[model samples]
Target: MISHTSISTVASIIQLSVAPVFLLAGIAGILNVLAARLARIVDRARSLEMDVPTADAEVQRAEIRELAILDRRMTMCHWAIGLCTFAALLVCVVVMVLFVAVLSALNFAVPVSLLFIGAMVSVTLGLLLFLGEVTIATRWVRVSEQFVLKGKPLYDR
Candidate 1:
């Protein structure tokens, strides 16, 4: 049986954990987006690879350039995912430390604060990496460039 004091402590910990739980939710959302982007990139690369044998020289050259860009963006996205995952893990640690400190009457103020700060920095870096990947994606050849059947050159109509 849990004592009233223990119940109160647990309640307080739950309350404190709310913010980190929300952070975890946001990280999960980021992970979802990164994962979907990665899947699409990989799928496109594989499809292009399959068609390479039959592609004309110009199309093959364009595909090669696109593949290289995709590879770079893929690497950046992977780094973003890793850093965000680390941030989420740190948030989990912060929550656990908060509970432990509260229940044991220990002063973990510095550790908790530092962990939260590190998590924030990690999240920031991860977001920057994601931004870099997305910005580079604009240079990828578009459908307009590929078809180019009835457009006024697309550069200076």
Candidate 2:
């Protein structure tokens, strides 16, 4: 029973919602790439430690410092991604609310309510994943710091 104009309005609202979702997806992809690079850096640091002579203390220290810098950069990237993800999620919530409002106004027979609920759940899951990544990056940074300052091996207890 909804008029054509109402349906078009709903479509427009949904279209507007896509921008934030796409932005978040892009940010997430960047973070994933950064995480992989950090893993590689950790592996290279380990390899360097094994190859370096213990008597060459200055060289060993320099390598450790470099690794620590990489870790800090990774942590910063992780936090930035986490913040972007959180903002995108907030935008998603607003979009979902607008969607529901438009659907109700149209009085469409379709169960668009379920779609709105699903969007909310998906955003929640995304937030949780971002938080988990942040936690991991923070631990990695801490380990790198210990290695640089105390001569401890990475991941040491």
Candidate 3:
């Protein structure tokens, strides 16, 4: 019983929803990267944890310090993942509201705009956290390498 006008409206709504759907795909890709980094961090942490107990005193202290840095990196990565996931969820809601507004014959422009803004903010923060995590990991590696190259062992051989 749908008229041509209704079909056209639905088509327009679908067109409008395309950008957000693309955004969801982008978010999924970011999530995949974040998850992979988190996995590597976890694996490294586990290996360090296993080595900590039997390490000599100097090596044990260094391992503990490294573990602390790893813990902080893990926390930042976790938050990034959470924020990005939230952003994706908000985008989904925005798309749903767009279609619901059409069916209910109500204007949802303000809510849609607000939801999109929230999503952007969340994703921005998520990326910032990811950057922070990467920076810490890179810095730690540089320090460890410098110590090793200068005739100081950073870990037990």
Candidate 4:
């Protein structure tokens, strides 16, 4: 009993819902990049500390201070990225739910039903990405410990 206009309206709603999801995805991408850069900077600092002469205590202390700052910054970046990733995932879930609810309410055709299925798949992918980020972040502490406390190169045996 749903009219053509009602189906079109539902389609528009689906499109509107997509905007926030896309925005969150963009934010998540930026955060991912920031987190990567922070990690790299921390790694470089660790390597520099290793190469510095051991006899120069004052210089070594200064380098250690710098490394500590970089470590704190990297930790902050990791947390920020994690928070943004979780937020993006929540936004994606909300959009998917809204899309499915609207399409079902309007009793749309096969294509709209397929679109809802696709949205669910997208939600699943988002959740996977979020989980991956968390896993990487958890391992970061181990990586930092190896580089700083153990003074081991990342690729060393």
Candidate 5:
């Protein structure tokens, strides 16, 4: 029951979706990076938790502070991963709607445009959260505190 016009329409929709498919691939790469970061954060936090129980009072205090920062970083990473996942899902929906629009012979320009915009917004938010975490991780880092002698770090002295 499929007509020639219908076949061509389907082909056209596939062609249109090629770019979005590539976009999905790119998002997958970003998601991989975000997930790996989250895993590393979780691993570090777990290790710290194990060490804190056996440490002296001062070390325990320091460990607790470090753990708090790690907790914040993990939270940010979780948000970043969540937003990126939402973005990828939205992109998938956009591709599906594109196909439906073509098959149904209906205008979905507005919906397509809105969905693409939403995906971009989600990606932006995710990257922003990741950047915030990196900033926090680096801002209070002390390179010399752990490597010091003669009032200078060994590496820099």
Candidate 6:
């Protein structure tokens, strides 16, 4: 039989775990976005591969360059996803440690704090990698470049 005090302690632990749970949700969302970006990058690379063989030399060169950039973008997105997942795992461990410490009547402050700090650092690095991937995507490829003809507007009046 659990005492009222034990119930209250469990309630307190749940309350303390709420913030980390929210953080996990946010990490999952970021992971989804990163995975989508990676998929798109893969698709684009595949298309470029198919187009390369029949393209003119100049166009093939450009496609190769774009493929290289896409590769970098894919790498960055992969790293971001990995780091965010690790952060989410760390958060889970932190929450578990909190519950274990409370139930076992042990002091786990240092470990929990360290795990939380690691989670923050991992998430921060993941976000930075995401930003880098986005930057490469926007900087290396201009949408208008696709619409232009040989030194002229795609559609002139």
Predictions: Cα RMSD each: 3.8, 10.6, 4.9, 11.7, 2.9, 3.4
lDDT, candidates in the order shown: 0.90, 0.61, 0.96, 0.63, 0.91, 0.96
lDDT of 5 by residue, 1-157 (tens): 9999988888998999999889889889988988888898899889999999999999999999999999999999999989988999999999999999887879999999999999999999999998998899898576665688767767797
> How far is 76's C-alpha from truth in model 4 (Å)?
0.4
Residue-level error in angstroms, candidate 3, position 6: 0.9
lDDT per residue as tens, model 3, 1-157: 9999999999999999999999999999999999999999999999999999999999999999999999999999999999999999999999999999998899999999999999999999999999999999988886456458557686644
Model 6 worst lDDT run, 10 consecutive residues? 148-157
Cα-based lDDT at residue 1, candidate 4? 100
Q: Runs in model 6 with CA error above 4 Å?
A: 145-157
Q: TM-score for every candidate vs. truth?
A: 0.86, 0.48, 0.90, 0.55, 0.88, 0.91
Per-residue accuracy of model 6 over 1-157 as CA lDDT, tens digit each:
9999999999999999999999999999999999999999999999999999999999999999999999999999999999999999999999999999999999999999999999999999999999999999989967575577666777761
**Model 4, residue 87: C-alpha shift (Å):** 1.3
TM match of model 2 to true structure: 0.48
Write one digit per residue (lDDT tens) for candidate 2, span 104-129: 77552234445444544555554555
Top candidate on TM-score is: 6
For model 4, residues 73-123, the per-residue Cα lDDT tens digits are 666556655656655665666566566767677444465445445544554
- Spell out the clash pairs found in candidate 4: none
Q: What is the lDDT of residue 145 in candidate 1?
A: 60
Best-first order by TM-score: 6, 3, 5, 1, 4, 2
What residue pairs clash in candidate 5, if any at all? none
The digit string of per-residue lDDT tens for model 1 on 1-157 reads 9999999989989999999999999999998998898898889889888887899999999888888888998899899999999999999999999999998999999999999999999999999999999889875646766445577555554
